[model samples]
Target: MTQPIIKLNPHLFFGGNCREAMEFYKSVFGGELVLTLYGEGPPDAHKDPKANSEEMKSKVMFAKLSGVITLLASDNPNNTEAENTGQFGLSLEGSDESIFKGYFDKLAEKGQITAPLIKQFWGDTFGMVTDLYGVNWMVNITANRD
Candidate 1:
């Protein structure tokens, strides 16, 4: 038996605003945005009698930003708002400290910085912020042993 390669990709669910959010991310991350709307989704998506296909035709059913990293998102079927902002956060770690800090700064634009980028007890530069998309991000640069 061969071991399968595994990787973690954060998936977000939004209430009808996924397209707008994904566009914002494309601008920030400079990635190829592949988006699908409810009207373009699988047969089941269009088959749901409760689903407002016409109104949600422009809404993002599934979106992916593929580049250095891949981010995925979709519109919530229930059309309900997220109960809490602290549900989860994406943690980014990179080898280059400057690049990591740059990402942190970009993510913090027009957003709240819970923690400023600074040296942590573990000797890494770390910070936490809630971005304009209402997604939490944690940026960290590993300690330099050399």
Candidate 2:
């Protein structure tokens, strides 16, 4: 009666200011906007003046393109004179939910888990984690039939 959801999609992962970059990408590749989600997380904090930067707050937390491809991002994750991770990765997705779970679990053994494999607000079974080498990885199994 129950079958694991599958995600047949592609996503792009970026360092910081992903929003601005996505907008730039939109210019390069045209696609009608479907949705843009902003993290309620207080990116703006008086503790650090950088956090209060008007321009930074407006950066992209996450953006979806063409209804299928997704752009995943965060604000540098560095508060102080932090060294830029300066690293990026490409996400791969497919339907077989179980297979992806196994893959993600194994990867997490030596890495960081950003999101656990679970139903997402966007109606998809999704999870994100970084590998031991500090590479971000996203796995999604679609819950939405569409």
User: Best-fitting candidate, measured by lDDT?
Assistant: 1
Predicted model with the maximum TM-score: 1
Computed on alpha carbons, the lDDT of every model, listed in order, comes to 0.80, 0.56
Worst-scoring 10-residue span by lDDT in model 1:
43-52
Candidate 2, residues 1-91, lDDT tens digits: the string is 9999996444544445455545643443356444333334465534655545664465444466562344434444343222334265545
TM-score of 1: 0.87
Query: Each model's TM-score?
Result: 0.87, 0.40
lDDT of 1 by residue, 1-146 (tens): 99999988888888777887778777777879999877775555555554555666667778999987889998876764543356789899987987788788888988889999999898988899998768999898999789
The number of clashing residue pairs in model 2 is 3
**Candidate 1, number of clashes:** 0
